[model samples]
Target: MAVETGAGARAGMEAPALEGGAVLGSLLDLKADALGTYLRARQRHGDVVRIHVGPPGLRMDMYCVFSAEGAQQVLASESANYRKDNPFYEEIRESFGNGLLTAQDADYLRQRRLVQPLFTRRRVDGYAGAVAEETAGTLASWARARDAIVDVSDEMMHLALRAVSRILFGADADATTDVVHRCFPVITEYVLRRGYSPLNVPRTWPTPGNRRAAAAAEELYGVCDRIIAERRAGGDPAEDLLTLLAGAQSPDGEGFDTAELRDQVLIFLLAGHETTATSLAFTLHLLGRHPEEQARAREEVVRVLGDRTPEAADLDRLPYLTRVLKEAMRLYPAAPVFGRNAVAAGEIDGYAVPAGATVVLAPWVTHRHPRYWSDPDRFDPGRFTPEAEASRPRYAWFPFGGGPRACIGQHFSMLESVIALAMLLRAYEIEAVDTEVPLSAGMTLRAEGPMRCRIRPVRR
Candidate 1:
C-alpha cells in the first residue's frame, strides 16, 4: 500500500515495531479485519506500534497511536505538522473529491472556512425542528406496520438521510433519495475494500472492483446533479442551506460550479448522514440490550418531555439522555479510526516520526483505554457524569475528536441524535431481535448486518 508522523517535547527511541503475528506481513492481517489487525498490534506492542503493509516495494510502514496522549500530541498539540492528505484520506478523495472531508492544505482551510458558518449555533438550532419532524415520520411508518419488526439500522439511515436532505435541499426528494438508497452502499463497500486493499489498483484500471466503485460514484453524483437541477428549474424553495452553499463565492470571487456544488452535496450526504445514523443506531442497540439503561433514558424523556416531540430547548433538560448518547459514542464511536499523515518531522511520546508517516488516531481504542475509562468494556452512562468527566483528560473521550479540525457538524449530530432517541424512547419499548449485536468497520463502525429490533408501542 502507499506509505506514510507527529511531535514531541525527542528522536532517541524508535517507536517499537509491531512483531509476531504481523510477521506474515500486514496484508494478511489487514485482509482479515483492519481494525482487529491494528488492535492486535497495539495489544502486542503498546500504544504506538509501527506495522509494515503491502507487497514488495509497494509496501509501507504506518505508525498507529491508540492512546489519549498520542491523540493529543498528533491532533491537538502539534496538529499543524500533520496535513489532511493522510493515507486514509488519499483513498477518500476519489469518491468525495476536494470536499471538506477530503480537501488538504490551503484547499482544506478554504473549504472549512466557507462551511463553518453553515453549522453556526443558530443554524444548527433551527434544524432541530426538521430532525424531530423526520423522527416523527419514522414513528408513523412503524405504526402502520402489522408486526413492526423493523430493521432499526436501515430505519436510522433512512431517517437521517431524510432529515439531512430536508436541511440541505428542502423536502420532496423522492427520486434523489431512491438513487442514493440504492447506490450509496455500493460506493461505501468499494471504498472500504480499496481503502484497505494491499494491491495498488488504480481507479482508472477497469478491474471489477474499480468498475463497480466508479459506477456507484457516478450514480451518486448523478443523484446530486439531479437535485441541483430540479431546484434550479423549479426556482427558489425559500432560503435553505443548499441555497446558501450554492451562492457562496470562493476567495477569488467565483461561485461554485455544478461540479463543485455536487462535491459539497455528496460529502454532506455521505459523511453527515452516515455517521449520525450509525451513532443513533448503535445508541439504540445499546439501549435495547441494557433494558435498565433504556428505562432510565426513557424516564428522563418522560420527565423532560411529557408526550410532545423534543425541542431544541428541551435537549438540555434531559442530561441522562445526553449521557446515554455520550456513553454510546464512547463505546461504539461512529467514525472510529481516522488518520493524519505528517507533513513535517515530529515526535510522539519521545518516539521520532519522520515526514510522510501516517499516524492513525483511533477513537474506538482510545475511548475504551483502560487508563482513562473504568470497566472499559461496560456500558455505564454514570461514567459520563459531570464529576467523572471532569476527572479525566479532555481528549480521553473524543467521539467528535479533538483540535481545530474536529467535526463541524458535532452540534448538529448531537442534537439530531438526542432528539431522535428521545422521540423513539417516548413512543415505544425497543428490544434487540438478536441476542448479540455483531460489529463491523466501514468508514464508520456499524452493526455487522441489518440490526433488526422489536418495537412495542408504549401505552398512553
Candidate 2:
C-alpha cells in the first residue's frame, strides 16, 4: 500500500515502496555510517519522505523534519502519536526486561515519577563533591601516563562509569568494571546491528551477536543483583541514587519488588554511565580538534573556579564550557537517532501519517539541518551563546530532545560533564591526534577507533 499524502497543504510527496524481504535486507546491510546515508536521502527527498524497510506490504514513514516547528510538533505537541518503538529498546527488553527505558505509557510514567526526585536539582547538586573528587582522582591517574597514546574514549568511559557507580551505588566497584566493560561492547554491537535491520527474531533463537548480548546483559545484571542483595542484607541507608530508589515507594502506594528493583538499578547504571561517557569523550575530542575553543574553555573554567573545586553553583558561571559541551552534543548527540511508532493517525507539518507508522526524528539530522542553522556543519560554540541562542527557536537545538519524555538525566549529565571538563583542563593541555577520525553512531556516536590525543600536564 502506498502512503497517502496531502492530508493538508503538503502533497505530491509519495512514500517509497519496497518488497518486505528486500526492505529487510537493505536494513540489515546498513552500516554504522547508515545515518549519513539516511540524511543524504532526506536532503534529496524532503523531510517527510517514506521508506519501506520491513516485510513486504509493511511500510513506515520516516520524518527528518529539521525545522523548529516540525521538531516541536513531533517531540512535543503531536508527540502522543509517537511512542518509543525501536529495535534498540526491543533488544534491551529482551535483555534487561521492562525497566524505565523499556516501560511504556503508564508504567513508564510511574517509574519516571518515582525516579524523578532522585535527579532533582538538590539531589544532582549533592553529587558535585563526589564528581569533583572522582574526576580529580581520575585525572591524577591519567597524568601519570601523560605521553602515552591513551584511548581517551576508553579512559573517559572508565572515569564516567566509576563516577556514576560511586554516586549511584556508593562503592568504587572496580572489580566489576572489567566485566561491565566486556559486556558493554556486546550490547552496543548487537544494538547497532539490529537497529538497522527490520527482522524480528525470537529471543530464544541463538544468533551469535544476540547470544553475546544476552550473556553480557546477564553478567551486568548479576553484578547489580549482587549489590542489591548485599544492600538488602545489611539494610543501611546510604547517600546514593540506588539507596534512594531502594527506599522509595511508588506513587500509587506500591514499592518495587526485587526483580523490579534490579531492573531499574541496571538501567540507571548502564544508561547513566554510557551516555554521559560518550558525550564527554566526544566533547574532549572536539576540544582537541579546536585549540582556540579549548583555550577559551580553559580560561572560563579558571576564571570561574580559580583553583577551587567546581561546585554545582559554578555550573551556571561556566558559560564557555557549557557552550562548548552543547556544541559538541549538537554535532554528536549520544543517542544520535530515536524512533517512534505512531499509535494514531496524525498530521505532522501537513503530512498525513497513519497509525502504526514508525517515525524517526534525529538530532543528528536536525542539528545539521541547513534551514534552521547558519553554517550548520561548522563547530561554532557561539551558536549556544546568549545572543545566538536568543535568535533561535526552541527545539532548534535539542541534544536532550524536547517535550515530556526528554532525557530525565539532562541536568545530571550536564553537571557531570562540566565538572569532568573543568578538572581535566585544570591539569592538562590536550591536543588532537594526527588524523581526523570520523564519527560512527551506534548506540552512541563515537570515533570508529580509539581517539588518541596528546595530553601534557599544565603547571600552575
Q: Using lDDT, give the best candidate's number.
A: 1
Cα lDDT over the full model 1: 0.81
Clashes of 2: 2
Question: What digit string (tens of lDDT, one per residue) describes model 2 on residues 1-460?
Answer: 7765543446433444322245453344235355676676568766665655545655434544545677788789977778777656677666656788778888888788788877889888999898888898888788688565566788889888888888778863664677777887787677666666556676668987667877888888788888887777766567677778877786567767778888887677668888888889888888888889898899888878889888999989998899999998888888787777778877666666777777777788878888778888789998898988888778878877789888888898999999999989877788878447777767676677768888887776
User: Candidate 1, residues 1-460: lDDT per residue as tens digits?
Assistant: 6332333423446788876343445767666676677777777877888888776667677888988888888888898887677545677777777687777677777777777777888878998998998899999999986687888888999999888888887754555677777888888887777777656567898988788878888887877787787666657765667777877766788666777777888888888888999989888888888999999999889988997778888778989999999998998899888888888877777787888888888888888788898888899999988999999988888978778778888999999999999999999999988757667667888778777888999886
TM-score of each: 0.93, 0.91
The CA lDDT of each predicted structure is: 0.81, 0.76
| Candidate 2 stretches greater than 4 Å from native | 1-8, 11-29, 54-64, 146-148
